[model samples]
Each structure stands twice: as C-alpha cells, then as structure tokens.
Target: MTYYLGIDGGGTKTYALLTDDCGNVLGKGVGGNGNHQIDHALAAQSIRKAAEGALNEAGLRIHEISHTFFGLAGADREADYRILHPLVQDIGFTRNYSIDCDTMIGLRAGTNRPYGVALICGTGTNAAGRNPAGQHVQVGGFNYMYGDFGGGGSLNIEVFRSVIRSWDGREQTTLLTPLLLNFLGYDSVRDMFDDFQDHGKHVPVHAAKLLFEAAAEDDAVALEILNRQGVELGKSASAVIHKLGMEEDRFDVVLAGSLLTRGDRGWIRNMVEQTVAAVAPNAAIVTLATEPVVGALWSAMDADGHAVSQDVYDKMRVFRNFEHIKHQQDKRL
Candidate 1:
C-alpha cells in the first residue's frame, strides 16, 4: 500500500499525519508555528521538524512516502510559494506534492461530494466555495485591517472599543470591563491603559470568548456584538452560495474556526443559523467534521479529477475525532 502524508500548518501550531492507502493513521507529529507571516527560517524549521518527527514515528524514511499535501496559511501569493518551495523540496520525500491555503483543505474535507463552501472564523476569516460546475467564489479574507469580520481579531477589536466607550461614558458598562481587566492582568481599567501602552500588543483576539460568555449571561452589549458578527458572516456565506447557485437542496456550510465551532456559547451559531435560514432556508450548517490533513491528502490525489473513492473517504474519516479540541483560554489550555 502507498504511504501518504498530510500537513496542516497554522500560525501557532503545525500538525502532521501519516497514513496508508487504507487511511489508517500510522503516525502523528506536532511542530511549532508554520504561518507564512513568521520568518521563513522559523516556518521551515517547524515544517522540517514536524515532517521528520512524523516519519520517524511511522518507521519510514523521507523518500519512502509517495505523496505529500500541505495546506498552509502563507500560500496565498506567488511569493509565498517561493519562500516555502525550497524547504519542501529539500525534504526529498514525495515528488508528488501540492500546496494550498488552509480554506481549500477545509472546503474539500467536510464533503463527500468533493464540492461545497467552506468559511473560517478563527484568528482570521475567509470564505471559499466550489460548485459542481467547477466554478469558484471567495469573499473577505483580505486581512485584518481590511475585513475579517467574525474572526478573532475582529472580536478583540470590539472588546477593546467597548471598554473604551464604557470608560468614556458613551456606552453602558457591562460585565465585559471586569472580564477584560482580569484577562489582561490589570488591577483596574486605568491600569489597563498603561499596560496597553507598554506592550502595544494586539489584544488576544481569542479572548472574544469573554464576549461569548457575557452573551450567555444575557449582557445586552455582548449579544449585540455576536449578533452583528453573525449577520456579517451570513452575508459572506450568502455571496458564496448564490455564486454557486446552490439554492435547490441544502448546500453544506463547512464552519471552521474558533468562534463558529465552539459548543459553549451557541450564541454566534444561533445568530448565524437564524440569519442564514431567513435568507436561504435550504442551507445546512455543520462543523468541518474531518481534520484538514485528510483534505490535504485528497487534494494531492484528486487535483486532476472531480471524484474520490469511498475507500479513501472512509479512511480519512477515521482520523476525524472533530470534538477533541475545544476553545479555551490560552493560559488555561
């Protein structure tokens, strides 16, 4: 049986998986940050370590693998490929290799039919969809300053502004102020201002969990934020569904990312479900049920075709224990 490898490279962590033709996982590996935004050396080091570690665990040498599929954040540009190519080529494992943005993998992962829409709302946001007709559409995903609504950065921005407005008395103070202070390690709001100046760091966008918590507690301001985020994401999804002309049966929405996939709040999911149902009653929203490594493998094998075998599909599903990872505070996790 042929050996295949898939790599999911993220901003904070990298994942590697090795499998045989039957889809049984042979080995798993973990590595540091592989995001393109980081320095090329650092990113390559992470990928190399992950690939080597996984191969070692699987009791195989690099050249023994037949194919490798890498889905990563930095492959959005030609320049990015230039930066990543040498590292991958140097590995000398799979002569058959493919690279794509993370969303491409997600789009392919959650579907048995091989075509559907995938939208992510983690540290960032982006949407992509491919129809049976082979045409495609994408929305947002530009960058944080430009768009990325419903993403971690967007949530952080909202919380920061809410605290500012509350302090200025322009908006009513809610439970969010104390929550923010506690998360930021500030004794008080005034102390937070000083700390912000000192670090000048981007607030933990993932801390939007606090807003979700507040909404669960029925804080009006937090609820409004989540509602607005839902509307924006709904609009993004609508654009993809319409472009694909999938108004007949319920088209799949592969919801990936921290904000949309969590079971705790249910506020964002509820808001999106309500708005999307109003616009397109046939839409079916579900989490991306497979790990992206499976998608990467599919991309490598089927890039030249439109269909995948049930054997391959079934094998991929074996690794998709999709509920193992939950959203929690970084320090807590």
Candidate 2:
C-alpha cells in the first residue's frame, strides 16, 4: 500500500492531500499562510503542519510516502527555489519529491494534455504555459512594482486608492468611500489613513468582496474596477498564449483563484472569457472546480510512472465533491 503526498502552498493557506497510487484520496489537511516571500519560517511551518496533519489522518508515517509534489507560491526564481527547496526537502521526509510553482499544478488541473496555459488570479496573479515541444513560457509573477496586476491584492489597493481619491475630491464621488469606512469601522477616510500610516493598518483582502457587493448594486466605481481587472487578467492570459505559440492550437486555459471563482461578481469572469476568446479563439477556458492538490497528486502519479486514466480523474473529482459537501455539513454542527 503505497501513498503519495501532494501539497498546494498559497499566499493565504496551505493544503495537503494524501492518496494511494490508484488516486483514492485518504486524507486532507489545511494550514496557514505558505507564501515564502512573506516569511520563510511561517511558510515552512505551514507546509509541515499541513503535511503532518494529512499523514496522521491517513494513519501513515511520512517516510512511508513514495513520492511528493509541492506546488508552492513564490517559487518563480532561483532565489525562491533556493529558499523553498530545502524547506520542502527537510519536511517532505521523502527522497523523491519535486517543487514547482503553483501555476504548474494549475495547468495540470485543467487538462491532462501536455500543453496548455494557466492563469492564477488570487491574492496575486501569474501566468504560465507550455507548448507541445515542451517549451514553457511564463509571465507576470512578479509583484506590483514589476508590472503585475489583477488579483485580490491589486483590487484592494485600487479600491483603497479610489476611496482616498474620492475623499480628496480628486475623483468622482464613489460608494467605495462610504462602504470602505463602514467595512473598516472608521468614521472617515482620514481616520483610516491616519491609522494606516501610524499603525501599519491596511485594507484586508476580504475587502475585495466589498467591491463585488458594490458592483452587484451597480456602483459605477466598483463596476469599473472589476472590468479593469477582468481586462488585465485576459491580457495576461493572452500574453502567455502568444509567448507559448499556442494561439493557433486548441488548448486549455485554466482560470484558478478566488477572484475569478467568486460567484460571477459583476460578470468579471464573463469579461475575462470574452477578452481571451477574442485573442485565442480556439482556447478552452476552464475554471478549476476541484482543489489543485488533486493536480499535484496527478503529477506525482505521472512522475512515478503510473497510468492516470480518465476514470482516475473522474474519481478524484467525485471525491473532492464529497469532501466539500462533508465539510459544509460539518460547519453546521
């Protein structure tokens, strides 16, 4: 009875899944922030805690795992790899393990095909694509100063700026100002600004949801922000497609991340889809309906020379759905 481990480490949370060679999920665990850029010790702790929890739930020891795949955020450059590789190696407890950026697992999660693109827009944004010749193209993983845009962080920043502008009378009056004040429990934008400057207080990521709520009410400012983000996401996806030379090829473009998956707010997903379709007409846009840890599991099985059939993929999907339902039910208790 061989077990495989798969981990998806993100800015907000770390998720670990333990499964058998045949794709039967045994256990899953989640932990805190895993973004290495934020804090190395915190990231390592999150990864280890999540993995250990999953292993324990599976009634197995870490050393019993045959292989592991870690799909981690902030693993783009050599420096990132330098910091994360050893951490993974130290905590993995397995000799056979691989570390890759989150986008790789996202690509695999969309389709079994060897060539496709993945665009992740969550707390941050990144794009990666692979061509049939095994060549890869990546774009826009760097933070805001490096020309990256379209994510929860970016959206939050934009909303904050808009509120400030409205307060200063530099921009048209926006509901964001009052909504932000209410959300942050501040009496005025000046109070919010003072707290931010004095205490390092900042807009929370959940504030992005407020933008959607405002958009639902047809607030012009919120709609504009959502539309802008949608365009940016689409353009990023297009850039990856062109760089990978997949424009003419029919390939899967996996859209993963909370921003895109969040309940069709302001038709942001529709805007993204329309823009991408204009550029890559043959590309299929896919929203990741299951956890990306399943993709990491699939990658581990593939690397270990196991045949991952469609039936296996279907079973994983079903298991994920069941787990989601059970989790929801547990919350009620």
For residue 256, what is the lDDT in candidate 1?
A: 73
RMSD of 2: 2.8
Candidate 2 — worst ten consecutive residues by lDDT sum? 317-326
TM-score of 2: 0.92
Q: Per-residue lDDT for 67 in model 2? A: 83
Cα error of candidate 1 at position 294, Å? 2.8
TM-score of each: 0.85, 0.92
- The number of the candidate with the highest TM-score is 2
As for candidate 2, its clashing pairs are none
Task: Show pairs that collide, candidate 1.
Answer: none
Q: Which portions of model 2 show Cα errors greater than 4 Å? A: 319-333
Over all chains combined, what TM-score does candidate 1 have?
0.85
Model 1 per-residue lDDT tens digits across residues 1-333: 677778877665676788776667787676666776655777777788777877988999767777788888666667777877776887664467788777778777777665777877766677778787888777777575666665776688788779878987999978889888888888887778777888786787567788877887888889888888777777788787787887665677777765776633566666667766776687788777667667876775565343557887876765754233222223355
Writing each residue's lDDT as its tens digit, candidate 2 over 1-333 gives: 878888888887788889997778787777767889877899999899889878988999877888888888898888888888788877855487888888888888878788898888888888888989999878888788987885877788888988988889888888788888898899989999898899987778778777887788888888888887778778888888878777789888888877776544536777778888988899888888777778888888777777788888888864454345336645877
Q: lDDT (0-100) at residue 312 of candidate 1? A: 70
* Stretch of 10 with least lDDT, candidate 1: 322-331
